[model samples]
Every structure is written in C-alpha cells, then in structure tokens.
Target chain A: MNLLVDAFAWIFDPAHQAGANGIPTRLVQHLGISLLVLLVASAIAIPVGYLIGHTGKGRTLAVSLTGGFRSLPTLGLLIILALWLGVGLEAPLIALIVLAVPPILAGAYSGFEAVDRRTIDAARAVGMTEWQIVSKVEVPLGLPLLIGGLRSGTLQIIATATLADYVGAGGLGHFIFVGQKSNDYPQMLAGSLLVIALALLSEGIFALLQKLVVPRGVVANQSTDVRRPSSRRVAVVGFPTEERK
Target chain B: MNWVIENLPLIGQRTLEHLALSIPPIVLSFVLSVPIGWLANRYRWSRGVLLTVLGLLYAIPSLPLFVVLPIILGTGLRDSVNVIVALTLYGIALMVRTTADALGSVSSDVTQSATAMGFSPWTRFWRVDLPLAGPVLLAGIRVVAVSTVSLVTVGAVLGIKSLGLLFTDGLQRNIVAEVATGMVATIALALVIDFALVLAGRMLMPWTRTVSPKRERRALPVDEAVTA
Candidate 1:
C-alpha cells in the first residue's frame, strides 16, 4: 500500500515534473518517437498495402512478411540493431520502423479487402475511371479499417517504445530501467503507470477515429466493423479476425 | 556459431524455462476463456463490456506489466509467477475474444437442429457447438501458442529467466552470436509449438480436413488465423 502511495507521490512530486529527465519530457519523448515511427511506417506501408489491396497482386508477400516479422522479438531486434549500429537513435528507430510496418500494411490491405467486391464492380459499372474507383469509392470506404490499423500500430509502437530505452533511445522506459538497476520500485511503478496511460489514451483516440471514419452509409452494412474487436489488434500485428459476412 | 556450441546447455535450459513459463498461461487462459466467451456470446449486453475491458488490458505492454505485477502480488521482483500471471491476463484478453468469435462462427441452423433433436443446451454445446466450433477455436489456440511462446522472451527484461536472458546477457557481453542464437531459439520454439498445435488440431478435428474447400471458404477464413 505504501509502495503505491510512494509511487503516486513520486509522479506528483513537482520536482519529477520538470527538467530534462522529468515526467513531461519523458512523456513527450515517448510519444514523439512513437509518432515519428508510425508516420514513417504509414507512409511506407500504406502505399505498398494500398497497392496490394488495390491490385490484389502481392498478398502472398504481405502475409509472409508480416508472419516472419511477427515472430521476431522486439528485444532481440533492438539489441541486434544496437549492436550493429552502435547506439544513438538509429538503432531503436530502425527497429521500431521495421516492427511498425506490418500492422499498418495489414490494415491498409485488409481495409480494402473488407470492402464488398460488388461495390468496386458497381463503381466501375457506373463509368468511373480506375483512379476514381480507388480514390472516391475505395479510399472513402476503407478509411475506418485503415485507421484501425493505425490505432493498433500506434498502440504497438507506444508499448515497444518503452523498450527503446534499452537501446539508448529516449522514452519513459528510462525510468523503469534506471529504477530496475537501482532497486527503486516506486520509480519503476510510476514509469509503468505512465506507459499504461499513454497506451490507453491512444487506444481511446483510435477507437473514436475508427468510428468516425466509417463512411456514413457504409456504417449500416455491418461488414467492416463486424469482428473489429476480435481481430488480434493492439499488441500483435496482423492476424486480424477474419471477415465473417 | 562456435559460441552457440559452447552455450548449448545454457540455451537448452533457458528454452525449457521459457516453456515452463508459457504453457500455463496458454492452457489456463483457454480453460478460463471458453466459458467467459460463451457467456459473452450468450448475452448481448455483456459482449461489449467484456471485449472492451479485455481489449484495454491487451493494449498495456508486457514490460510494464512485468514491473508492476510484483508490486501488486507481493512477490519478489524476479518471481516467474509474475510473468505467468501477466501472460495469462494477456492470453485471456486475446482468447476470450477469439473464443466468442469462434462460437459465433458456428452456424445457427446446426445449433437449431441440435436443439430440435431433443438434446439439451449442455449436450448440444459438447456434441455440436463446441465440436463444430473446433476448427476456429483451434485456430485461435494456435495463435495463442505462437504468441505466448514469443512473449515469454520479454520476461527476461525484468531479470526473469527464459530464452530472453540470452538477449540481455549477450547485449551486456557484446556477443552478437549469442543474441542471434537467442533469436533463432525463440523462433524455433514458436514454430515447433505452432506446428505441434496444428498437428494436434488435425488429429483432434479430423472432420475439418475432409470438409470441401468451397464449403470451407464460405464457412470460415481459417487461414486468416495465421495470415490475417
């Protein structure tokens, strides 16, 4: 009980709230790294995923890549990159980018996959151009699932960024590692609390975004969001619960 | 490579420890999830609350959970039990949803037939619903197995013994071979376990094998359990 009290006290201690190593700075560092990684990952992954989902050409590539990457442990990869790159942000940044790609890619392609095939054909039948079908129809309808991919990717990055400190990158994980070394249990607990709060905050924001992007008429269909909760989102990448309708 | 040869015993011991920590959560969570999954699927209102809460739980990272569990459980910081409990919670969060979805995947006509045939709900679940839900349930369990095996490695960050020890130990010593060995060993364990689960699923649910592919496609996207 006292341990809990002390940890809360440590977090609220105004001393811990300001300065280079303070909670706010650590929080920003964590969110900043995660956001950067997600943006870059989305830029790379969304294009490729969109291409695959649009063309239906490289699904085999997406599946194998995500499966292989999913099994690769974050700690092992971070250590290998750190060992190879010799610290600084490069190691963790590269590792996080590699890990973040799969979910976003899965989301992009699966969002397209979730769209009814007839809907695409109908867009074509109505005399729309190929690009028009993609941009005006597919993109609008797929937005929710794409955002879902981002949500899970954001959640995964935030969680894994906490491990970034192990490779000498900045994040709230610094406190946990430092506390672990010095046997400062309260500090460790506080760090854990901060990371959890960040993860939940992102989850909430993404859930709302997913709901908002549902493309008003499409929301009534119940096709896209059917198993959204059941898909192995959040921690693991891909393995989205299969579309049932 | 030579480093791996020299550390074979250490690697083997760590692999065993990893399995020891992993198996309980996978099994226990599956046992706990089925009923909870049934309850959620049985009642409309419970599904939203159950899935949302569990989803939030899953969103929390494994590392933080490791550090915080000891505080809650009053165990030593290094206790393997903390990893077990944390992983079990994660497993439950994952499997409960899968279980509910798997049960949901069972066709209503079949269930209605069983009820019409004079079998009670209990008998229907055992003889019809569960068995019919078997393929999807197996898919969910296989995922749980692979991920559980992989996640046990994270426990090493807190100084808990598992295959993850090699990463931390190797990093500290700057032995790339040792770290590489840890990665290989962890993936190999996950693959082997995944394969075993598939084989077990085949043997236990032989009817799934003979089900026609056209019907199979219409019924469920079982392969998505691996590929999404």
Candidate 2:
C-alpha cells in the first residue's frame, strides 16, 4: 500500500537521519527509559517477591494488589505525576516504574508457589540452608515465572515509555504524538512500526534469556507442555488440581 | 479537596462515564471469547499458534492501537466505537488463553465420567465443565474488568469521554486536585469491581465463601490483566 511505502520512506529519509531530536536519538531514549524502569522494578520486586514466595505469607497481597495495580491508568498517572512533580522525566519515570511493578512482583512470589513441593522438601531433607535452598532450589525452579513477570513488565514499559513525550520527556512517542498533531500519517505509521518492532525484538530477546537460564528439567517439560510453555508456572498462579486417586 | 467536594456531582458523572465506556467490552469479549477459548482448548494443534498470536497482539501498544482502529474500521476519528472496539480486541487477547486455561484446568477424568454417564456434549459442558471452570473463568473476567476500567482512561487521549478527561484537563489546566481525584477514582473503581467479582464468585459458588477473600484469591489468581 502507498501508506506502507510512505511510512518506510519517512523512516529512511536522510533529512530525518541526523540530529539531537532525530529518530535514532528518540529510539535510544525510549529503550534507555524502558530498560531503566525494568531494572528498577526488578530490583524492588524480585527480592520482596522471593521473600513472600519463600514464606508463602503474602499470596493475598500478591493477588489483590496486582489486580489493583494492573488497572491504574498509566497515562493518567503520567498526567498526575507530571502535575505534582513538574513536567519532566521524574514523573514519567515514576509512572512507568509503578506500571512495571505488579507483574515482576507477581512473577516472583507466584513462581515460588509454582515450585514442586517435593523439590523444596528434598532440599530440607538434605539439610540445605534456608538461604541456600531459596537461591539454589526455589529460584531456579521459579525462574520461568520470574522471567514471565519480567517479560510482561518490560513489554508494558516499552509501550508506555512512548507516553513520556506528554511529560516533556523525549522518546518515540514524540514522533507519534507530533505526527498525530500534524496529520503526518506516514510519520505516525513509522513511529508505530518502530515501537512495535522494538517490542517484538524485546520479546525475542527475553525468550532467549528464558531458554538460557531455565533449569534443564524444566526446559524438557517446557517442550512437552504446549498450552503455556510455562504450565508449571500457571499451575502455581491459582488453578486447582483434583487428585485423581 | 474543597473543589472536589463541591464538584461531587461532576465526579460521579465522570466515574459513571468511565464505567460505561469500560464495562461493555468486558462482557462482550467474555461472551465471545468463551467459544473461541473452548475451541482453543479442544484443539491441541491450534493451541500454540492461538496463544502466541494472542500474546503478540497483546504486545501491541494501547495508544497506537487506539489511533489505528479508526483507520482500520473506517470509522470517524471521534467515534466511541473506536475505543470500544480497541478495548474488546485487548479483552479477547487477554481472556481467550485464560478461559482455555480455566477449562483446561478442569480434570479430564471428570469430563469422561460425565460422558460415561450418558450426558450429551453440550449438557456435559453446561453441567460439568462450565461449573468446574467457573472460579478461574470468573477470576479472568475480574482481571478484565479491572483492566478495562483502567484502560478506559486511555480513551481520553482521543477525546473519548471518560474519567481520564479529568487527568488530561487537570494537567493541561494545572489543577493537581482534579488529577489526584481522577487517579483516586480510577484506582477505587478498579478495587470495587474486583471485590464485586469476588462477591459474585462467592455467591455463585458458595463453597468459595468458606475461604476468606485472601485465601480464595490465592487459590484463584488473576494478573492476565498485567501479564497479558
């Protein structure tokens, strides 16, 4: 389609190729913010999630709080944060971090829930230290779900990081918003394509990361379990299993 | 705070608008995704492709999708259908796998026994499978409900009316109170819907009430809202 051609053309145009506000600069800014938010969210969520999962005392908070967090409007939060904190990076950064937290948090503790009880019981029978057991046994077994949380959080931040433009922060959203304002359909499409590409690329990279770190036994199970490659993780999230016996 | 207190009626109206724009897509998608979910669960071959496609669709950003919808549907830029249709697409993407998982969670042996007892397929689904799958399906629905309510605010980006207008209007006008109110209202609405679904689940399946909300939620988790 001509629209498609125009979009590609706009992306490749030389005039748009080199500058402070150029596409490449925006792309780096976008990815930088997304990566920073993902790290911060992981830092805050992973340890707490691991503790809660290990203790099994906070499943209620995990379930209900994430449900609440999932629904907080990101754009609105950006607006609110910008109003209170001044129109700058801090607002969008905070807003994006809040958006990124719930999944990472859920993935962690729930991933612990997903751990095979026999595995943990085996660790205890062998007199493994509590910390050693968590680090050596639980976390590895729970890595898939923890990674699932990361996958979810990263994708969300990537999508949302675009909204930074609204708060006077620079990102690909600037292109999209400006394109929308000027009725530059090609540029809008170009920005959308760029964003979608980045998101898909991130997913591929994470999938590779998941494969690299997943324990061998789980990796074997992953190939067989087709519904959710992480069926073990799903079983832990809240499905009831009936005893056939 | 004083302005928000004096403007209670406007707040109520905007909240209602928010719910109206949000709730329909959840119900509409739930009704439609059930059969699609059923098919996905029933067909082993299609399951992988189905979930992967949906997951990819889920990855599409909400804002761009909002802008793209009008162009794809040949609708006017301002039509509320744009928002409804976009939310519905997202809802279906999120719920189909969850519904499939809920049905999949129903043990095969149970369904087999019902079949052996001479129940027809449709009756078996209605009597055996659907009831057993109810808790998980309902949990997924609640997630969708919470997500939809929150997502409705994004519709304001295109000037689609909802509580999100307060955030936009407030920010543009530098009224932090209005923005704060919208934030509080949106979060509150999400919690209320989540609890309402919990109550509905308990009432529909009285056995669940024995477990407190804490334990019950634990037994049946929901974050396809966030995860998807």
Please report the candidate that would top lDDT against the real structure.
Answer: 1
In model 2 chain B, where is the ten-residue run with the lowest total lDDT?
Answer: B219-228
lDDT by residue (B57-79, candidate 1, tens digit) is 99999899988888789998899
Badly placed stretches (over 4 Å) of model 2 are A57-59, A222-245, B199-228
**What residue pairs are clashing in model 2?**
none
Best candidate, DockQ: 1
Docking quality of model 1: it rates as acceptable
Query: For residues A17-97, could you state the per-residue lDDT of candidate 2 as single tens digits?
Result: 879878999999998999899999999999999989999887897887886678778888899888888977999999999
Sorted into a CAPRI-style docking class, model 2 comes out as acceptable
- Give me the displacement of residue A241 in model 1, in angstroms: 35
Reference-based TM-score of each model: 0.91, 0.87
